[model samples]
Target: MSRILVVDDERNVLTSFQHLLGKKGHEVLTAKSGEQALSLLGSNSPDLILMDIRMAGLSGLETFRQAKAIVPKVPVIMMTAYGTTDTAIEAMKLGAFEYTLKPFDIPKLTALIERALAMGQLMRTPVTYGAADADARAQRIIGKSSKMIEVYKLIGQVAPSNVTVLIRGESGTGKELVARAIYHHSQRAERPFIAVNCAAIPETLLESELFGYEKGAFTGAVARKPGKFEQASGGTILLDEVGDMSPSTQAKVLRVLQEGTCERLGGHETIRVDVRLLAATNQDLEALIRDRRFREDLYYRLHVVTITVPSLRERKEDIPLLAEYFLKRYSRELQKSGMRLSPEALERLSAYEWPGNVRELENCIKQAMVLGQGDVLMPEHLRLGQSSAVQLRSAPESLNAVRELARQHLEQAPGSAHQHLIEQVEAQLILEALMQTQGNLAQAAKLLGITRPTLREKISKYRIQRRVHLNQREG
Candidate 1:
């Protein structure tokens, strides 16, 4: 059952909704005025809010403004005896889910309530990141690598400010988690966090989606609608895959960034917004600027602060901790809490380079939990890329893995594959050479056909240790 808040001045109106919605299996919270509703909101996490436009102490509009700051993601339906006006339109433009005239049809209102409840649930499930957040419904970004620590530091430094943050990383590297982490820590933590994927929505509709539209703006534009930027006023809006945004939308977004004001599509009124912008992308924006596909002005605006998340392969040392966390988390989720990760399974996870990063590992764990029968999650259940030990055992498999990695690099970051692959192979070769020579730099350089000075420089560049030992885990 979901929770619903019904706020009104009339005792009869509140009583009616409490009885009517309670029968529909809702935990109804009744408030006699907007002030009481705001108080209830502070103490409760209601899925849907039904409030009157006119009330004592504070008008519904004023109450809504404050309520949004408190629970921006929750859907609110405003009831008013007064018909459509600029005031009502202003309320909708400011992110009220719907404005319904009083004495609304019971069936239609119930349907609206259900829809609002679902929409709220979809967006309001807070993303738990750090260890201190204990929301059971949330997920944590588990990693303690030096690179991840740097990311945490960046989030802490920039989250408190309103500067636009550009989160750069490969797909599935948990960029959104970093964004949410920043949101959770920011001053606007109580406000909404709206994420819009520029790549997911079509270019034609992207503008209207981000900036809303007025009725009759285009074909089938039946009524006025507020865009995400307007809905996210006084909150945060994350533009994921923003590199894919069209030039027109980029200009409009640039305007918002520059002036904090935007005109809705097909509407002339300028809507001043207060939103913290966070853009995440896997694509190379600098190259896009060079190619003239992306605007340099907008790029600079977003680049005021950038947090680059390292790829999984770049931080392989964290794989054990990440994999173990996922294993335990998914076990609980899949209702197979008895299952555990085997030592060999963890080895396979660590030895393999994850192309899809944390998201792929999560899926691997969930699938293994759902499919594996015994107490242990094994290698066969993994169906993974070549792990270090396995690849070394088979030349063909090693070649295949190498080819796949190279292909991925070339596809993901064009023009970097040559140096990337060279360094990757060179690092591995250096590790093996050092192991063969017992970490003697001279002997290792001779075995690898490289000069001692060059090998030493490469080791330093790669942050590799001069001495090697087999007392601990894999190299």
Candidate 2:
């Protein structure tokens, strides 16, 4: 049975429809005003909304408009006792699924509701609904950080034009997110946004992937195929990891950018594609150009609108919000209730250096959510420091302080070296993990997913032996 929400100011009409729909085996909810309906919507999304045309406070038409704003795809059937041509026309114009005059045929209304439900199910999936806020409809950027705000501004400024965008960032820093943000917010938002990773594909296949190929283009070419450019005509194409692309492919890409035209491999016909190109690279493209690995002309072409995504370390302030967001997101999926991070745990997270950036932070949070025993997440829930057998020994004011401590101890020690750089970092990580695990090394190693010996090597390397001896002597 489909879920339906009925909104009307009349108690009698609401009772009659609720009884009728309930007996027909459909689950029904009732709301007297738009505010109540909105509250209901926040909890659960109904398949269809059956609204009376006139109501008190907020009119049915205004309610319907608000409903569309919240959940654009839900089908709404407007009902009115006093039917007029203008009302019907206005309802249709505003995308109402159907219009019914009050005291009307109940059977016809039921059929229309069923049809609207079926149509809604076929048109869009709920997962795709409200994927982001309404403001993000034009851009897929999911951030409120100052860095991302600047990225959003750049998107708005360059979206209307056919400017090539070069997005630079560290690996897993969400370069593609920025690229998608640009594509979805641009004039080509309605069109397909195709992304091709330059490094993943083989050199030979990269050309054929960007430009179409004739049936006889190469020995393996059995049928004609369209390239990324052709498929993205009048749309946007993202060349991800562009710095890793082969020099030969770089030359081909340069031609497409300069001429807006390409010839299929082994095909004489020249095809033109009006595609806006967006390129992304973690590597410095200028350095690649200087090394003769990337074409300078191509670099200039793709750098028309540059957007640089800051590493997670640069925006540590966003960690708490991002952690909460992911906590809620994964908690809902896992059906776990009352999940939240402790302030201490969040502080520990914010102090660390996220080498892997957002991707690493997301993974850490996901792991923590799975390990958390109660509503609140503690430092032990995260296995970050344990990954490399490194145990951070101090709660420093900054990442730089931690690094400085590690360097000072390494450089100033006059005895047999206490630890190598890697060993110290690893020992620090392991110590933090052990503290979180309540001194359970086996579980800590398991959390780190390493054999006890490897963990032991890190412990011995860090010269924690003297500390253990001192504890034994004191005991």
**Residue 180, candidate 2: alpha-carbon lDDT:** 66
Candidate 2 per-residue lDDT, tens place, 232-279, comes to 677778899999888878887888899988887888887877889999
Supply the global lDDT for candidate 2: 0.72
Global local distance difference test of model 1: 0.80
The lDDT of each candidate is: 0.80, 0.72
**What TM-score does structure 2 among the candidates reach?**
0.55
Which candidate ranks first by lDDT, i.e. highest? 1
User: Which 10 residues in a row give candidate 1 its minimum summed lDDT?
Assistant: 466-475
Over 226-269, each residue of candidate 1 has an lDDT whose tens digit, in order, gives: 88898788888999999999999999999999999999889999
Candidate 1 Cα deviation (angstroms), residue 421? 41
TM-score on alpha carbons, each prediction: 0.67, 0.55
Deviation in Å, model 1, residue 438 alpha carbon:
53
